[model samples]
Target chain A: MKFDFNNNIPIYIQIVEQIKTDIVAGKFKPGERLPSVRDFANETKVNPNTMQKALVELEESGLVFTERTNGKFITHDTSLINFYKQKYAEELTLTYLKRMYDIGYSLGEISKQIEQLGGNK
Target chain B: MNTILELKNLNKSFGAKKVLENINLTIPRGKIVGLLGKNGTGKSTLIKLINDLLTPTSGEVLINGKSPSVESKKIIAYLPERTYLDKSMKVAQVIKYFAEFYDNFDSQKAYKLLEELGLDVNQKLAKMSKGMQEKVQLVLVMSRKADLYILDEPLGGVDPATREYILDTILSNFNEGASVIISTHLINDIERILDDVIFINDGKIILHSECDKLRTEQGGSVDEIFRRMFRC
Candidate 1:
């Protein structure tokens, strides 16, 4: 997974987001071995410890699972994937609504705008 | 929260320099304790004494109602300011050694962590950079589901991003009913996560209070109160 070091977010967070994106995008197929922490760290030029943290977060969130001696693999649970997708989608929508509301957009106006822009995606 | 560790009138001095004095503290189980102190204020010394790496010159320490001993060592997972590891050993070897010594050691967790860290069991510790070595040490320490985890300067001298990751590791890991005591002057980053704090100055515990109560009652951050109490 590619990392943007200069991003305003923390590197571990960036790593977490990237890995989740990969899982969501099917770049990491179910049961596929995730990259070794050292390889990921070396590739990103970040500390292995930092990389490990991202994986731990992923594991905690049920996006990945680890098998001793074998290695870490992407979780194959379709419901779990949908769970995260819906969770993040709702969060982003709420955040966008908040931002728009802060700029004086009413709830009705925002809802109307979403309906107009909904088909393109 | 059971009393996991207690210190009574603890005092320490090196030559003419007094590092800590009249330090009394009781660490309860299942809380994140933040030990705040500036450089040379004896934060590390306090941890060393608890781990029995250094004998306290004065006062008493009790782990599970007895003096710190081999049995107590079995229960505590200590991460020192300096990495105390055999650099010659491979990452897998150290985990095995820890597992052998500590019956509570979880091999599956260790292997899973190594996999997550992307560390090969065959990789030599000496070959890794200092930062990698630090990660290895942390992974080993955290892999254990110990009762009391003592971390000294867990984020010292690391890049900001790595520091964030280290903090996350501390937060995400550890077992239930296990208390984690992190000693560091980096108050701003860890203030939010700490359940309680003990501020040390000249080897004495000048302030001891719950972080939330202190904030709510005093209407200030731990760092602000720390600066006020420590102001020269």
Candidate 2:
């Protein structure tokens, strides 16, 4: 997982975003084990408590599972990954579309650009 | 559309030191508000005044556009910064007490939450861990389904897992047209869920805005802005 310490966003949220990206990119396959909180925090130079908060949010959202003695692992379900990816994609696309429209882009022109970018499929 | 609570030029002091000064806040219904401030600020005092636990030395506190009275107490559910549960009482007894007092209390929801938290109703408050007690307190406060939910330091002294549970309980239990105020110094953890925010310092409001608009106008995350504004 990657963390940009210089970014203004909170460290925990950055960790969450990176984990989600890894899940979508297949870096963490279904049912794969994740590094323990301490090890991950040590490697990333973040507080263990902050890392724990990110992992807790993931578990709460059903993207990860924690075993008391064993450790946290990626959920054995890609559907959750797909679900989040689609949700995020739709959110991001709407944001982009809004900004484009605010800049006076016509629907036809936007559609054409999207199509040219292989969005029509 | 009535003002659910208002503080008019309220001033409060503890011993020889002044805490809140000329504090005025008017809160409307159905808004989820974040109360942001550093430690020892008057955020908790504001909550206490609303709940009638402490009286303002000067000025006024109103509930539903009237002075805070006994009837106002009936509609407020207060979760304090520290544990308020009687250590000798069992969870079941606490639930029963709350049910007897609150007109809108939902015992079933409380039991369901307890079960989800892996807590048994028969567990004594003294026997449970600190995190478990916090959960119980949250369960009791949320089960009331009051007109106003005033949670002081709701996320204090709890694990993130339990904090999520507490937040979800707050989110799921409140009905439409109900308002909630969560006071905390930990802004980042709860920033995403806040509809509005009131930033307090030394018992005075320094900032108040709709959460999204504040983030957009400031052009940074709430935590970042807070860190800058309250730089140490």
Tell me the tens digit of each residue's lDDT in model 1 across B129-208: 77777777888889888999998887776667777667657766777678899998988767655667898877888888
TM-score of each: 0.64, 0.67
The TM-score, computed over Cα atoms with residue i paired to residue i, of candidate 2 is 0.67
Stretches of model 2 off by over 4 angstroms after superposition: A1-121
What fraction of the correct interface contacts does each predicted structure contain? 0.00, 0.10
Residue-wise lDDT of candidate 1 within A48-74, one digit each (tens)? 555777799899999899999887989
All models, RMSD in angstroms: 10.0, 14.1
Which has the greatest DockQ?
2
**Model 2 docking tier (incorrect/acceptable/medium/high):** incorrect
| Model 1, global lDDT | 0.80
lDDT of 2 at B124: 96
